[model samples]
Target: MKHERGLLIVLSGPSGVGKGTVRKALFECKDTTLQYSISMTTRSPREGEVNGVDYFFTTKEDFKQRIAENKFLEWAEYVGNYYGTPIEYVEKTLQEGKDILLEIEVQGALQVKKAFPEGIFIFLAPPSLKELQNRIETRGTETEDLIRNRMNAAKEELDMMDAYDYVVENDKVDSACDRVNAIITSEHLKRERVSNYYKRMLEAE
Candidate 1:
């Protein structure tokens, strides 16, 4: 059998666009063995979040220190908090012949693609900006100022959607998950990959 190719699945979306839910569903696929790239954040976990799993909770000072040390793959600031993807985990997983899923913002996704040129980028967009605004407002925990700030930021991020490899519309949870999962599964069976495998096997025979 030929060696399998690894995938770098970089996912991006505006705030409250259902990225997490879509990613969660992808993990449930039978043959899907992609690992999630746990990001480091200075923001505190709300509730029931495990340290080092859900996120690598850290101090602002420590986060800055990581930046100084050049440890982060990609980092970005939002709503007065800093978030970064850990480069080591990404490298290790791909080295092991496993795919990785990175959930980050659009700007950070651009940074990641520059670092790993072969990575696949998928952008999940809401049905509409109005729906995105409703999702934020319906959350009910944020102050008016915070909600307004995020909505404005989402508008800016939406403009960057054209840079992605695949654009998925998150109008419904199940439908959106299916679209994202299909994109990944379809990539695994590309003609060049299959042709390369046959070439290797015939040479060995």
Candidate 2:
């Protein structure tokens, strides 16, 4: 059998679009070979969140130092904290033939697109702007000012949805996850990937 390179899947969306929830549901599928790329963040861990599992929690200074060293594939500051994707881990995982999912903000996602143009970019969107506002408000995680800032950012992100390869409506978590899973499955079966496998088989024969 010919070994194939793993697919890089980038999932991005506006805040309160339920991207995190959909990602969690996607991992529940036992048949998936997908791995989650743990992002590095300078924010304090929330209740029930574990270090290295949820995020690689670090101090702002350390995170800034890493940024200066060009260690991150993509990174951005949201609200008051820094979040970034470490390039080394992601490259190593993909080399091991495991598809990895990166759930990040729009700015980071665009940065990844520039760095890895072969990646499959998926945009998770809310059913409506009104619904998105409601979801953010219901979470009660941020103050009014922060929520307003996020909403403005969301509007700008939505305008860039055309740049993504796929757009999944996150009205229902299960349904959104289903769509994302289908996309990954289909990407694996793309003509280019299958053609490479066939070529390798012919070469060996």
Candidate 3:
């Protein structure tokens, strides 16, 4: 039997929305066949961040060259650092019938939507703006000025939540992961997917 193409699950939100935390929990809580797409960046690696695992670290020139060659599914520059998702790996993974999760920001997610409209877009949101600020401050990773800037960006990103197929509130990591898992399961059972499966079965028979 021929397997159907895997789902492209795009999980995106503003900074400090706990998208990463929820994604990690989803992986741990489910035995689903999924792969996490590792993004490429021109920024220097942080402490304890492995080269290939955390990000595919590259030089500014190399990253720009790839962008010129249209290698990225989506690319963006934030805080003077270039970050992008390489298209090759993601396409190969989908063709192999393994779902892939892309944990990205709002802008990149929109870009992906244009390139691959079939992908499932899920927006992770904070319970409230105040809670979002608290989460950002709690991280202690950014300066006051940077935090403020992120908050501004978050506001703009939150406004785009309607564009996503599903909006998941990240009030609690476990609950958020549960919602995400449910969405993925539901997407797999979508009419289009089921119809393809049914057609394949009839052909085989």
Candidate 4:
């Protein structure tokens, strides 16, 4: 059977929500193609982070210039640093009929929704606030203030979950990825391309 070309998957979650892990799992499926949008940031890349792969690190002036030119689909400042999705690359990827993934925060997700009305968004959530707090503490270097701030942010993001098309609980990697995979499959089946293909297959009857 012929399937739709690919998917535009937008994934959002707060810090320590294990979105990265789930994203990795989702990318492992053989039939699916996944690409993360490289968000430009004013913040410097940390140790071992690649220049373009992890993020497109740029200076404040360059970021501002892009903003002035309206080159970004969406942009936001966080903790004294700015981050944004470059419009040119995103449009190019979508134009190619390939799957595109954006693993961004809730704020960015909302901005994406405004630009791409048909975009599919999924929210990854921890089972509970306590589980979320515990997951954050597992890193073992958080200060009291940091922990509290992260917890508060999680609550804020969770409150906006309804805005997403699907919400998957990150209780288990396999199960979570399975749910996401199912969603992508179902969406592909819903496309008009699939119906057309089915019609062709039935012509012999």
The C-alpha stretches of model 3 lying farther than 4 A from their native spots are 46-48
lDDT of 3 at 79: 59
TM-scores, each model vs. reference:
0.93, 0.96, 0.93, 0.84
Collision count for each candidate, in order? 0, 0, 0, 0
lDDT of 2 by residue, 119-160 (tens): 999999999999999999998778899899999999999999
RMSD of each: 1.6, 1.2, 1.7, 2.9
Candidate 3 residue-wise lDDT at 16: 92
Worst 10 residues of 1 by lDDT: 1-10
Whose lDDT is higher: candidate 1's or candidate 2's? 2
Runs off by more than 4 Å, candidate 4: 1-6, 44-48, 140-142, 191-205
Residues 9-78, model 3: lDDT tens digits: 9999998998778877777755767799989988878567788886899999999999999999999887
Report the CA-based lDDT of candidate 2 relative to the real structure. Answer: 0.91
Clashing pairs in 1: none
Q: What value of lDDT does candidate 4 attain over all alpha carbons?
A: 0.82
Cα lDDT computed for each candidate against the true fold: 0.87, 0.91, 0.89, 0.82
Candidate 4 root-mean-square deviation in Å: 2.9
lDDT rank, highest first?
2, 3, 1, 4
TM-score of 1: 0.93
Instruction: Please list the residue runs of candidate 1 whose C-alpha ends up more than 4 Å from where it truly belongs after superposition.
Output: 1-5
Write model 1 residue lDDT over 1-205, tens digit each, in one string.
3336578999999988978778777777787778999989998885677887778999999999999999999999888999899889899888887889998888789999899888889999999999998988887777899998999999999999888899999999889888878897887777765787898779999
Please state the error at residue 30 of candidate 1 in Å.
Answer: 4.4
Better lDDT candidate (2, 4): 2
lDDT of 4 by residue, 1-205 (tens): 6444546788888878888678878778787676778888898775666888878999999999999999988898764678899888788877777778888878888999998867889999898889889988986767788889878888888999989999988999999999988887777777564787778779967
